[model samples]
Target: MAQPRKMLLVDDNDESRYQLQTLLEFAGEKVVTRTCEKTITNIEDNLFALVINANSLGDYSLETITEKYPHTPIILVDSNKNHPLIQQQHDWRVIGSLALPLKYPDMMALIRKCESFKPEDLPSQTINSGNTEVLFKKLVGKTPEITKVRENILQLTDSDVNVLITGESGSGKEMVAKNIHYLSKRSNNKFVAVNCGAIPSELLESELFGHEKGAFTGAMTKRLGRFEVAQGGTLFLDEIGDMPLPMQVKLLRVLEDRTYERVGSNTPIKADVRVIAATHCNLRKAILEGRFREDLYYRLNVFPIEIPPLRARKEDIPLIVQNLLQTLEARHKKKIRLSSTALKALNDYDWPGNIRELSNLLERLTVEFSNQLIDAAEISQKLKQQGRITPSRIPEARLPEGDFDLKELLSNLEANYIKLALEESDGTVSRAAQRLGLGRTTLVEKMRKYQIDRDDISETDS
Candidate 1:
């Protein structure tokens, strides 16, 4: 049995407010009715589970309410769904809007949905003193590799240069882009993200630059594009390598001129947006294969940052697990713990899907083993079910009879053995080094010299 949620219903119209208040009270909710003029004065004294606003706060901007209670969820009541205020509402706190004279079913459904709104799900706007650690609090790692990434993000905070982030899928490229955006000079504006690979090629241009009301067959109304929406902020172009060649040319032009026009309009609009592009593909290789343009690559790759996959930073697994479990507990309202052996099993397996895979596994565990200690055997069973477990085999060095470089052969053999040891030890440098009879620092040096990384080995295995 849970207590009734306290809801503040703000409506200027006396009849409408009374009707809504009576309905809410009938449903056993604690309803506090207030006119727009009096709501602000009383909003500070008590915490509210939800604020139902009729968008009729004369002279009082909703921005003030949102700014004051950033974590509180809001439900907008408007006669028109396409009203400029409702359409332009960019605050993430507003869960949904309803037409005036709301139906009982819709209102009840929305109330049910609001019950799941956890404060941790909201994105934080505060960046304390431009600290990279604070800006990247969600990054969840202490490894040197991730530390370098934070440092790179810190360096880019002051500049609006086009950043190209390259990494494997689920390596948190979008997360990196977001950290850069929140830490940059444009932190106060919207951070728009568009996936180049997800959108159809035909609609991608209009999606990026917007379209006129009659631009195409399905263009029923004029819509703001990602560029217009992200004005004075950052536009994150994820998986840019998958953008078509024609769109690439257009994007390059926009990058060069900082201007673009809607699909069916000739008026040029100045783009004051910063662009951050990310891709998992090798753009250089794509260029060689004629799948990508060389000039476009250079335009977006002005300040390149590559994120190492999760396997490369296995030492961060425990911290990541802890961070993820906190989020799970907040969302599910249930606590779950992993035994030391279970944690060790996770660190011993290669996370091919990286952080996203780890997060999914944690969620699954919460569903199946809530409020319980998960052990190594259970973790192994799940990994086996996912077909992620495979036996490691040692590589044998072969001598070539023809004209082969002895130095290159020995280097190849050493790299192979290192890769094998890393696979067997699940990428713990200390464990892998011990298995290879080499010091940790020595193993690291060899890995650097050979340009061998966990991502490289993961690619080989795949």
Candidate 2:
């Protein structure tokens, strides 16, 4: 018969240790209890699936245990629920932390999670960093830059180290984050994504940390925040650079302590989710202007991965388009082929909108033209129109070479269109909103996003 999984429990509290040992044994686990830190040496050669440490065990060499037993997961038991040091378990290489007075449900659940980790399931973090063809193929590219990114993603699957992914908007930063999470040890759990920039600053905290019922006006029901919802999983913070300054402080604290409370409650909950942050904004610039916290920047910059813009890696365009074409074909139930000349035209144009724009254009073509073969003439027409290279009023407009941030592009386009519509309407907001097909409130918000001065457009028109 296969031997039962073994767990090493360390605690000086006799009753506490006995309780945990009995629970593990009942669940078919080989539980080894060490009453003194000195006795840890006795099991130096033993192989354990997990190590549970209670604060009563006193100071022991965490590095020694982590290094010697690299595959074994270490979980901490917090006797004092509010103890500050418990927050730094991740930094100390502990994979998880449990509240004091262990409940069998919570303890067993965590141990069972750890027991599922097989050494062969993940390659060593330091070995074969680039050999992940399975995950690498998900991204369409063979360039060295993309290969390096694949290597980084492969390395991240084994541990819950914080990652900061930087790239222009729509450059697949979040997609890469998802690939890492889905292929990771925590794959069975959740993957929650939050757009830090979209939510208003006033409500961002409650959205992230959740709140108790009646915590505030209209908070009629208890809610689970993204952190809690993502527990034992991964949390992806998209557009992280736009997060308000105040929230940065709170985020850094939770990152440090691996814990947070509901908006209206003081009870600490373990923030066990792996964090992956992405941004198109230049954070260093934000830091210099005192907008982003320097300390928080460093904390989140543990392992940095910067994705190259689409223009920088144009060679990958063919493969990307091919994959996208297959999807379009299946969805439309039609055979669609791009003429060689049409493919060349696509390769020639600089894709400021990146992969997202490419996918959108293909979908639009499939819907509009159906199964008709796309040729160079149609490709050129649409490419120039969307690239903003040749509008009816403007004969030839050259976009700045290889420089277009998705947010900035959208904002600028909206602002310019609103200006044109206002000019055409003789500077009337109602008429302009009508022409732009936007509600007045949404138009106003877009105007504010672009910071367009009302007087400027009207003055030019007059």
Instruction: Kindly list the per-residue Cα lDDT of model 2 for residues 265-372, writing each as its tens digit.
Output: 999999999999988778999999998999998988899999988888888888878766765665576556789998898888887667776776777777777878
lDDT by residue (tens digit), candidate 1, 1-462: 865558888888887788878888887788777777677666643444555554677787876766666667777888777875565434546666667777887777677666766665554322333322243545767788888887788789779999999987778888889878866778756789887865667889999999999899989999999999999999999878878899999999999999999999999999999999988789999999998999999999999999999999999999888877887787788878999999999999988878877876788899889899999998988876544322353336576787988988888878877886766443546556767889767988998998877544331110
Candidate 2: count of backbone clashes, pairs at least 3 residues apart or interchain: 0
Candidate 2 global lDDT: 0.72
Worst lDDT run of 10 residues, candidate 1, spans: 124-133
For candidate 1, report its TM-score.
0.61
Model 1 regions lying over 4 Å from their true place? 1-118, 122-133, 388-462
For each candidate, what is the lDDT? 0.77, 0.72
Q: List the residue pairs that clash in candidate 2.
A: none
User: Could you say which candidate leads in lDDT?
Assistant: 1
What candidate 2 gets wrong by more than 4 Å, as runs, is 1-133, 388-462
